[model samples]
Target: MLYLVLAVAIAGEIAATVSLKLSEGFTKLWPSVVVVAGYAIAFTMLSKALKMGMPIGVAYAIWSAVGVAAVAIIGWRFLGENLNPTMIVGLVLVVAGVVTLELGRMH
Candidate 1:
């Protein structure tokens, strides 16, 4: 399904981003490889989902937004990054926007 493909793309993107931080400016070998591979797979999956009839704008929006949120959570949990109340609110708004876009397409 297109949605599943999109989810995969988003997950890959998040993994890539998290690995990027661990890559330490590309000086780390394994994490650097992971970053590159994850991004490649993410883009490949995204292209496939687009070919499956999902609108580019919708797919890209969902992909980027979800990727951002997932990466933020990963950073918070694993990278000692902090999320203040404002940041949490902003993330919620992003989720709401994604939900609104999905709902709009249902009719």
Candidate 2:
């Protein structure tokens, strides 16, 4: 249940970030609306996750790491944004760090 909330938070954040890129400095209408709504949903869900007993350190780490990875993938695959080897390595490091964080929590 807590993880479900966190997943929603992550999805909302990813949507918000992707919409932000498509907003064209807020000149675009629907995408801009999505940016606002998505962030609202993201934060709301994140708060819910926290209230549901997810530690802030773990929740935020997962949320941010997943968001970063999803947004980068979307940008590269759909938005035609540059994603080079360096960025790939960086993303790998981010994922590894998040995994470490999760693993550390089990101890």
Candidate 3:
């Protein structure tokens, strides 16, 4: 299903992004390889979802926004990055916008 493919793409993208951060500017070998492979899988799944009747704009918006939010949380929790209230608010707004776009497409 398109939804399943999209979910996988999102998960792959999040994993890829996290691995990229752990790659330490790509100086590390294993994490760097993971980053590359994860991105490849993510994009492949995204392409499949597109072929399955999902709108390109909608899918891309959701994918990118969700990826950003997930990465921010990962950074905050695992990377010791600071996330103040403003940052959380901004992420919430991004998620809300994505939800609105998705809902609009159903009409």
Candidate 4:
């Protein structure tokens, strides 16, 4: 349940970030509103997940790692950004690091 909440937080954060990019430095009104609202929901859910007993380190690590990867993909797919081989390698490394952090916590 906590993990699900964390996932919602991550999705909200990703949506917020994508909307931010679409906002054109807040010049666009709707995306700007989405940016603010999405972040609000994200932080609220994330805090709930934390209060529900997800460890801070693990939760943050997973959150950041997944967020980065998801945003990168969004940039590539929707924003005309490059999705090159090097970026793929870097995203893989981020996932690996998150896995390592989680595995380390099990000990």
- Candidate 2: misplaced stretches above 4 Å? none
Give Cα-based local distance difference scores for all models: 0.90, 0.95, 0.95, 0.94
lDDT (tens digit, per residue) of candidate 4 on 17-64: 999999999999999999999899899999999999989989988988
How many pairs in model 1 have backbone atoms within 3 A of each other, for residues 3 or more apart or on separate chains, i.e. clashes? 0
Over the stretch 36-85, how does candidate 3's per-residue lDDT look in tens digits? 98999899999999999899989999999999999999999999999999
Best-fitting candidate, scored by TM-score:
2
Q: Lowest summed-lDDT stretch of 10 residues in model 3?
A: 1-10
Clashing pairs for predicted structure model 4, backbone only: none
lDDT of 1: 0.90
Which has the better lDDT: candidate 3, or candidate 4? 3
* Residue-wise C-alpha lDDT for candidate 1, range 41-69, written one tens digit per residue: 89999999999999888898899889888
- Compute the lDDT of residue 44 as modeled in candidate 1: 99
Per-candidate alpha-carbon RMSD to the true structure: 0.7, 0.7, 0.7, 0.8
Better of 2 and 4 by lDDT: 2
Give the runs in model 3 whose Cα sits over 4 Å from its true position.
Answer: none
TM-score of each: 0.96, 0.97, 0.97, 0.96
Clashes of each: 0, 0, 0, 0
Name every residue pair that clashes in candidate 3.
none
